[model samples]
Target: MLERNALTFNPGRDQDAQPVGSFTDVRELQQELQGHGIQFLAEADEGTTGPASFIVVDPDGNPVIVDQHV
Candidate 1:
């Protein structure tokens, strides 16, 4: 999971059987990826008052998270 208050990536797995990301600021990371021609598997699903996140794929086609806790 993309923890908004996290630092370095502490590798781990999630309930969905996906590895959790260790970074915050989904949009910033997304921009960085876009600069390199990387596309998101899914975009952030924001709400009027709740959490938001986006999804992308790793080299092995595994889903990675970029999240913001607001």
Candidate 2:
């Protein structure tokens, strides 16, 4: 079966998945989602072990984090 926003396909499995890899694109994604009112939570640093990150509340107020480190 197919899934909306699915980033992975498991031929032998029943469901698809979206892994951290899906968020690895830092620049383009930032621009694309800007219209959605994305907010910055943190900036990326070379000394840091992971990519820059941010947190935004969804329509339901659930925290959604976007990180591009992979």
Candidate 3:
């Protein structure tokens, strides 16, 4: 479902470092969604950081992107 699209997570491992705000493209948005989700709970357990923490889905149901900015 959500995995098939481009999913991006900012600050990657540095969630705490990410500034509190919502943004669309380079500009800022009105609301802030300060939360997180899991793609593969198993990998998350092993501590996968960088782009791996994020998950994007391909047309077929496979993860196309582990991380992306924007």
Which regions in candidate 2 have their CA more than 4 angstroms from the true location? Answer: 1-24, 36-50
Give the lowest summed-lDDT range of ten residues in model 3.
25-34
Predicted candidate 3 versus true structure: per-residue lDDT over 1-70, tens digit per residue: 3434444455323466554454332111101211233233122212322222333343466653333242
The models' CA-based lDDT, in order, is 0.56, 0.44, 0.33
The model with the greater TM-score, 2 or 3, is 2
Model number with the top TM-score: 1
Clashing pairs in 1: 1-20
The candidate, 2 or 3, that scores higher on lDDT is: 2
lDDT of 1 by residue, 9-49 (tens): 22233545475565345555556778898877776543333
The per-prediction tally of clashing pairs is: 1, 0, 2
Could you give candidate 2's per-residue lDDT for residues 1-70 as a string of tens digits?
Answer: 5322312212212234334333334444555567677664443343454345544455554555555534
lDDT of 1 at 38: 86
TM-score of 3: 0.20
Clashing pairs in 2: none
Displacement of the residue 48 alpha carbon in candidate 1, Å: 9.2
The positional error of residue 4 in candidate 2, measured at the CA in angstroms, is 23
What is the alpha-carbon lDDT for the whole of candidate 3? 0.33
Better of 1 and 2 by TM-score: 1
